[model samples]
Target chain A: MHPAPSVIVFTVLSGLGFGLLSFLGLGLPQVTGWEAFFYFALAFALAVGGLVASTFHLGNPQRALKAFTQWKTSWLSREAWLSSLALVAMGLYAFAAVFLDISAGLLGWLGAALSVATVVATSMIYAQLMTVPRWNHWLTPLHLLTLSLAGGAILAQQSAVALALLVVAGIVQILHWVLGDRRFEERGHTIESATGLGDIGAARLFEPPHTGTNYLLKEMVHVVGRKHAQKLRVIAFVFMIVLPIAVLILLPQGIVSAALAILCYLIGTFASRWLFFAEAEHVVGLYYGARSAQAVAG
Target chain B: MTQLPETSEKKLGLVIDLDTCVGCHACVTACKGWNTENYGAPLSDMDAYGSNPSGTFLNRVHSYEVEPRAGGCSQTVHFPKSCLHCDDAPCVTVCPTGASYKRQEDGIVLVEEDACIGCGLCAWACPYGARELDLAAGVMKKCTLCVDRIYNENLPEEDRIPACVRTCPAGARHFGDLGDPSSEVSMLVAERGGFDLMPEQGTQPTNKYLPPRPKDQLPDMDVLSPALEPVAGEPKGFLKWLDKALEAI
Candidate 1:
């Protein structure tokens, strides 16, 4: 089925951690205080946790050290190298901020680059998988940006500038989802054409590959109805992407509504990611007579 | 470092004819036999004789019923899937250790099983699902295209072919230098319009499958399957029980 949860947690948690660090990197002279130090510490914690969580998904966790050698051609290797580099940069920035005799300006830019590096590396992992049609999209990068924005906004009780960037990120995320969903919808026909006899209109299947169930039928061909998927998409829109934006917009006025929105976005995004994997159709599934039923109906 | 010449004899590849394949799984069996006998390890069958079982084979035949589109009969497409030994293999790139690598001279992708630690990322990275984990060996294994047989200089020149291609009864499998445009395999591709499995996903699979021929070439199965032969017209046959059992009742 899907990749393990430890990986999911690592990606999401590290996203948030890096977003917070990026804002702290801005280092506005007007804003001087414990808030910067506070956010910095928490962000570093999440980043470290994300790094640790990555190993759980590896079959041979020890061999992960060898990934650093292939940075010339492999994106996965680049991601590993970048993540470790970011980890080091963020630590240096933290030390410079709290205990060292260092200029605030230098500390700020370094933190910013590390934050950006972390998110970019995170996005590259899925984008590099040319085998997966769903993940290899322009929206993949946008998804990371939006998710990071959402994370940044959640931690934005202290800064107006960070809060503003979060709003922009939220809008971009929503647009990316809307556009990406349309692109994915058009794919049913391409998939139908690839497996069938190239006539998009006339393709029909009166039979399946086997009389009883098999792994391909179960794992690839889910009998989950389209109506259910649409409903879930709506839930993802409102709670995961939209609600957090609304909460941040209204947060200066109220407390309870803001708290509720934050809670909703977290749970909603987790479910959306799960659905992302669940609904993905591997072309190997097509060989086993799992045609796009939606394309046929349309 | 020792510098090396990059060019020599042409690297041979397989071109499978989709039109003639009967989907009999003969090549699969032939591959298992040759690999077990000659290769480093035999294809192990787990619980094969006892109960539910499985084993490895270099090639597998998959049969599909293709619906008529733009006025062709509902046809049967017997396409087989395997490793393409690509010029640029994603499976080679993502190997954490330097275990999986493409040959420097030829474009053959291979795994150093000794260095591999049994991670299934190579399987995940391959869009074609070409790689499979050798559960007993605690490492991954895949189609080597009978590398041991074809490359051995001691063998006679006529015997230098992949085992599966050598054993195919229908002559459906063609082996030759795909790099040469005038090669039989290359000309076959030019004549038949060989299609890549998933070009958009774009692993750039080297092996090409010619699209299935028209359904007219297929014999009428309704008449053929039922009319293979009659039970040798004799007394006290298994069919006599049908009449006696019904008469008694």
Candidate 2:
């Protein structure tokens, strides 16, 4: 699920790229009509750069176009299609903004709509896996919103409207943590249900299937994951949520401090997203000689 | 180019009784012996006579302490899980190549070693963790239900079963045509109320397990070793002392 190093870099980099694009799209209409044109063009460039950067992550890059064919079922296909469409819409918005000097109406709304679609599609990639109960939570949608909003706020630090949105984004981040913590907390409970056991849970493996580590154990079982999860939760709660908001509240001056706040929030969100994927345990983990939650206490 | 005629309504499976299974690992050894020779490639054992040596074994006995749900007794059931020969297999459907296919005649999920590109998608899709890629063979390997022996005309009628079943010391494994309702396998399952492994997975596994009976009525482990009489035994040798020291460790 972590994929490869290339995949991790690709996903994280693309997340920042598209997230900033969505924010820029939303922020453009709020600022001066002339400024919207300039930002839209710049954002279009960023979107393409991000898109190309992500292609290096694919195992078979040539077969990637066929991924869109599975859109009727697979969220991955949907993400690919939506990402492409969103790119096209953003590009068209850029063309209209730069060429026709169009600052408002369908062009503006199209960019915003496409941005929203891309965010939803991106989150759906992990959220759609029925086997992975942790990713299938409501926190998925919130993370998507926070991702773009946090990045958009940074790009919008020159103005007060983006600054205000950034604060709202902080509140959203805090809310996500408050609600999202329960998902990780209640993972054991879900596994018990999935394993078809009653209240008599906390099943510890007396012994593993084999003495040495296999693919499942190496791939699925996170030996240091619980600690990583705990550390990341603290990071997300304090660095991502609390500290940024506190900085924004204490510093009343303007966008300079807002930039720092946005930066902290972005760093926090990235860690949060990484943990979100890493912490997600698939049901297949059970058969792979993965000991239940009691293995953690040991 | 295809000439194999498919027969409908055939249910083939390996019936294993938990009551008789001694967990002696005879079937495990037999499976390794047969598959390594007859299958696509030999199951290799690396680092022999060294720190670590490991090889593939299709049949593995999983001994678990299960408390009887209906009855009051609790005993250990040595569960041997392999390819279930499911009616609707998730592993088969998920395979991009037509390599992993269910035989319409017997409903046994078999890997076509020739067609198998070793993509490893089937292994990931299986909930039971049945399919394993034979790295040495450069293909997938699994329990074939003694495909070569079952249909072979040269083998004796009684010995037409899988080598694992034939070599089981405790007579734990049973092989037969499950299509016939009145077959010994079906009758035994009906009488004992045999259960499927991980029915929640919805593989609809053909294989069934006979639940473990009460442990209390069985002879206690404590009664096995009788108290040694205070006999003036012969002088203990160096070998005896070494054996005692090894046992203590």
RMSD values for the candidates in order, in angstroms, are: 9.1, 10.1
Give model 1's docking category. incorrect
Which pairs clash inside model 2? none
Candidate 2 per-residue C-alpha lDDT over B134-237 given as tens digits, one digit per residue, 9 for 90 to 100: 54555667789979888878989877888889898888889876767899998888897777655655667788777554455545456635665545564378
Compute DockQ for each candidate against the true complex.
0.18, 0.09
Q: Which 10 residues in a row give candidate 1 chain B its minimum summed lDDT?
A: B1-10
Candidate 1, residue B121: how far the Cα is off, in Å: 5.3
- Model 2 per-residue lDDT at B229: 52
lDDT of each: 0.63, 0.61
Best by lDDT: 1
lDDT of 2 by residue, A58-96 (tens): 323454565555454445556677778878777776666
